[model samples]
Target: MKYTPVQYKVNATILIKSEKSGMLSELSAFEDLSIVKNNNKEVENEIEILKSRPLFKNVVKKLNLNYQYFAKTKFSKRLVELYDNTPIKIIFKEDSLIVDPFANFIISIHSKNDFTITEEGYDSIKNGVFGQVISTRIGSLIINPNPDYLDSFIENEIFLSIKPVMDIVEDYKSRVSIGLVHQDANVISLSLNTTVKAKAKDILNGLVEEYNIDAANDKNQIYENTASFIKERLSIINTELSDIEQGVEVFKTSHNLTNVTSETELFLERSSENKKGVLETNTQLGLVDFMNEYLKENKESLLPVNLGFSEESIIRIIAQYNETALRRDEVLKSTTLKNPIVIRLNEKLQSLKLSLKQSLDNQKKTLKIKLKDLQRQDSVMNAKIASLPKKERELRDIVRQQEIKETLYLYLLQKREETAISLAATVSSAKVIEKAYSSKNPIKPKKRIVLLAAFMAAFLIPIMILFFKDLLDVKIKDKKEIQKKLDIPIVAEIPNTNTKGNFIIAKDDRSIVAEAFRIFESNLKFLLSESNNQTKTILVTSSITGEGKSFISANLSIILADPDKKVALLGLDLRSPKILEYLNLESAKGITNYVSDKNLNLEDIIINLDNIPNLDIINSGIIPPNPIDILKSKRLQELFVKLKSQYDYIIIDTPPINLVADPLLLADYVDLCIYVVRLGYSDRELLSVPENLYKNKRFSNISILLNDVNINSKKYYGSPYGYGYSKPKSWWKF
Candidate 1:
């Protein structure tokens, strides 16, 4: 959520700050070379170190961040971080608290030292005092009073909590954002969300301080390691120098050694050059030996490259090896050796190591040949200066080696001093341009934005529900809706009238119901196309019984029969008949009686009504046990053939097509099928049944009729077609 939840809100939550950090790219002669160059990567790396888990865990441990203390002030409901002003201290074992990371409870301070837990546990700790350890449902804990706030907050509540430390660490990690002050610049901008002003300052400042300490320590670590190596070597070399000096002293004392005589001075001078060469060769050889030993001992560590090796190429190769090793170490800090960057650095280091050892081998071999040549020259010079005693010559040899060891020892001493300088001058990665500060208001759950969002949701919810309700409604709503769903052409949309009687059509009637039937009569000419040589046998059926197919049929018969057109209203819906009920006739003799007996004819079942002169009603007669069997009889077809010659239009009302096959059996006799669908009553799903019948050509033609559309409803009827006449004065006048 853009507006995060407020439950995790703390005091002084929004912190915005910036600082300039001096990220050390490389330490050359203890110089901070990063200031002049664009070391953007080092700046990013320092920021990462600031947020590292190890560093964050140090902060957590220092501040005891896992246990949070909060209390309300006298003026506000907002809980502020008690921080150093906590009334009571909570003591718990980390191991026990880890079992339930969210052990949130309250301590009610009745007095300075006395308190009780508002939320008790199974242990249900009794009232305890300051410094008293009591067992609770969460774990064993103690409440210690603050000497400063003890008198200030009595009969007051302190809300204490132990949040899961690891999760909180991650939450802060995500919450604290780092940005560059400008592109390719060393300065960094840091922002963090926290509630307490002091806590915010501490977190931001603590992070920068720890980062500086860590960076400084890392820089010094290399120099310290180098210093340690030089010290160890100096000790061994010092001991060697002492032993050689002692041997020289003993040899000279035993020989009573003297200086050169006049004749042997030139010989001694010539020999001195060879002795100096031997000393220089020995020193280089000793350094090579140390290098070989170092390579053999350390499989994965930095080598001391600044050790004064006579071979310049050897020093350069070792520098490359050490640099690669340092890179590998940096990679290892964030990930394991399985990382590809670490693996590649490992491979490069191995190659450099091989090159370093080869260089040492070639230099050591050259030094040995030079030393052997120097010894041969010295032997020749000694023969020329034969007057000198042999004991004196032996004493000089001892003294020469002692000088070499002393020189090497002094050289390591100088290197150690340089390393100490580097350690002392290790620079901090960051310089605080400005200490961390906070915003005037909190960042999340902005009141104005949240109020706007809530207002929008409140207004939109009801409208969306109503829109979906209308979209997915299963019942047929109106004529246009049915037209959109089905392929059948709607012949007429009949409006339901206010009259209580079923029959509405009359001579010169101008009611909306009568007008709707007149429109249906006119549409029949287009529907009854194949009725040129025969009566138009129209079958009125519906998907279900309550769709007003029978009511529409009787009204259509009266409208069609205008003295020029003879219309027969046949009641063929033998099961659950409604035509006789609508017309108010007591004639029991109907189609069923005529169809079963040969003595009864079609004329016996059909009755003429005086109100509608040309219209005749053929009732359902007696309810039959076998309506389907009666409709299937040969007499039914013969009856239809006889009626086609006498009547110009035959309106036959059959049983609902969805309920029985009686309508389907008469499919051969009917010219057109009027499928009646009642608006708001008929199910939209039933339109598919009629569609399937039309597709299979079960009826020659099927026209749709929407019945019972409310005349006054603008949504469905959309303005009735005619102005209706007033109700009759007496009920039966019309």
Candidate 2:
């Protein structure tokens, strides 16, 4: 027969038996602090409680297998037979299974001798033969026996020398480790490395059950006794509280203490009011002291302004005095002080000062009278509060006794109720802080650390990949990037237009876009000053197509045109016309046809709109094969000259600069070039193209019009027009 070697390791912890279901360390501190109050009495009570507990001897006696010999023999029969023929013997010591050899035989590996036995043979067998005696079960010996020796022992040639199995009750009582958790500890750390996880937990559970049951029984008995004591005291307390309450009621009625606290509060309030009155009177007296000192210096005649009077009559006199003094100062500045007019002013000042002195005397007498009245009232309130006193003190004492007795009785009643509930709901004291749990990895070959390492390795690779991807992305995302790369003034930053329709600026609609266009129109006059020229020709373009160049040209033209002026939006983006699509106009005939025919007049290809008051449009007419050559013709230049005379402002939506040369060819005709750069969509490096055009004077006035800008972005700093204008309601309503 062959046996395979296996190992099991488990870890578990138990909590100390606590009186309640909370942190044991904190409860122990409270208990220790309470001991100073009734040390001897509490100690005697605890001892009596321990002595009266149900004896665990009966439970231990029932757990003993030796009392049932028949069951014990049956349980150990197979184990005894496994070593029957060998010189080795098996014995049950307390609760442990022990094995030993009777003869002085040599320890051997595979029948090859390793060491011989001596007088102290059991220790030799324990240390030299089998390593540590962790655990054992039936038919599984700590040391494997020789088959020949086992057969001989079974045949009666070698006798079985087995010791008597000790009592299980004694072993269970002694082996179980149970006590209060440490003052600094809330749990017990148990390392039950044994044959199996279930057996390790079974050991812990048995100890826990014993601890919990004992604690619960003891706690129940204590609560029951305490409840009995409270029941007897409660009757006495109720009678005493009733007697004291009745006595207090009689005393209170005799002394008129129905609203004693209100009386005391009233007294305190009166005192406070009197104190405030005294303080105000004292402040007025201080003011009078200052006034009297001031009057002593100006006894003959007082200047009202020097008194710094707040009274109405004094203020009037001071005003007149100031006016006369001012006239005197003016005369001194320009003429002699003895001049007739100055002398008259001096006489008037003297009369005003005399009147002010009389007013101060009257004010001083009035304040003195007010102060005397306030002081008399304060004295009367203080005497009244002091009048009733000795009877209140006696009543207060009697009432205080009643209150104390009532409060104590109520506290005891509540405590008794709580104790009764606790007695009824008595449960176990000890708990399993940590259940028996083993590492998932095998005991012999560990793998928990390896698995953790593998998990971390898998988690970080993708995070690093995403970080690198974010670091490499460098397209322009906001206005800051445009400012950093381009060297031009961003004249207008048009916030994103979220309406369903493309054209936001119209005559009838007063939306945020319209307000923004108005702001743009205001900024435009400063950006491009038309000092001498009657008409302004603005060319709007970008470094590439789809940069919102056409959108700015269409909206800007509508904003430039007022009810009195004419503004034309020309779809000069001949390669791809967008103004007609934006305004929902037909691409019938425009600059293309007008330039192709030499006889075409100013009104030949122009289209008018009813939706916008003074705005007109010139569609791209037809998709030209070579639009640059057509734009460079003398007829196209002539067409601009005619439009300049007729229109107040002409907004030409030209093709993108890098894509076509039509804008640079007609640069001479344009008064101002607004280069549009769309945030997030246009390449960052392409901003330099417009920047170079502005620097080299490609046009008279050139600036960037950042289109579709995110207004909420931090790069915008803040909104320019405060989001939108608050339009006024029409006064010509029905």
Q: How many residue pairs clash in all the candidates, one count each? A: 9, 7
Candidate 2, which segments miss by more than 4 Å at Cα? Answer: 1-470, 508-510, 717-734
lDDT of each: 0.76, 0.60
lDDT of 2 by residue, 517-592 (tens): 7778888888767646878888899988888887898889878889888998888888888888887776677888
Model 1: CA > 4 A from native: 1-53, 63-65, 68-89, 93-132, 137-139, 143-219, 251-278, 296-302, 320-353, 373-395, 429-546, 551-570, 575-652, 656-705, 710-734
Query: Which prediction has the highest TM-score against the true structure?
Result: 1
Q: Give the TM-score of each candidate.
A: 0.65, 0.38
Candidate 1: residue pairs that collide: 10-195, 11-195, 11-196, 12-194, 12-195, 13-194, 13-195, 21-430, 22-429
TM-score of candidate 1 to 2 decimals: 0.65
Candidate 1 lDDT score at position 409: 89
Write down the lDDT that model 2 would get. 0.60
- 84 in model 1: Cα distance from truth in Å? 9.2
Residue range 200-230, candidate 1, lDDT tens digits: 6677777777766766665565676677788
